[model samples]
Target: MDDKKLVKTLFMVMTHRNEQVGLSLWNDNPQGYNQYCQWQTIIANPRAMGLGKRYIESDLNRSFNIPNPRTYEEKRA
Candidate 1:
């Protein structure tokens, strides 16, 4: 099947897990803003296709607001 067909199949079957709504961060610098948008797109679409960026044990979505992070993932927050 083609890429579009694969994406459609994934969406229809609901096999994806921990799928959160895509969020784009704001960047003050023009170049930085563009880069942020690009990165967000890169990460979001793959997850939409059932390819999550982080392992099932880690939740990148929850990493951002963490305080005094301990694990590598928390520090990555």
Candidate 2:
């Protein structure tokens, strides 16, 4: 019921299933989380929705701070 206990329980469950509740390098989970945040905020602009925005490189982390980068804060600004 408490946040700690809930997190522990979730962690155990995820660990048992070889799943992670956090970002995964193979799945661009960071970008996914960023986009999800953008959707929930007023900063949910076209750029936030994966529009006009270009990822010159396919690296999400690299794209994380490219001036008009695509990270959670950028999207949720």
Best by TM-score: 1
After TM-score superposition, the amount by which residue 8's alpha carbon in candidate 2 deviates from its true location, in angstroms, is 8.2
* lDDT per model vs. reference: 0.35, 0.29
Q: Per-residue CA lDDT of candidate 1, range 1-74, in tens?
A: 24333321111111123444332221222122232232212232334335543433345456567767765445
- Please state the error at residue 39 of candidate 1 in Å: 8.6
**Model 1 worst lDDT window (10 residues):** 7-16
Return the TM-score for each candidate structure.
0.28, 0.18
RMSD of 2: 12.8
Question: Residue 36 of model 2: what lDDT?
Answer: 20
Per-residue lDDT of candidate 2, residues 1-77 (tens digit): 34333321111111111223331432342222232231111122323224434222242333334567455434333
Q: What is candidate 1's TM-score against the reference?
A: 0.28
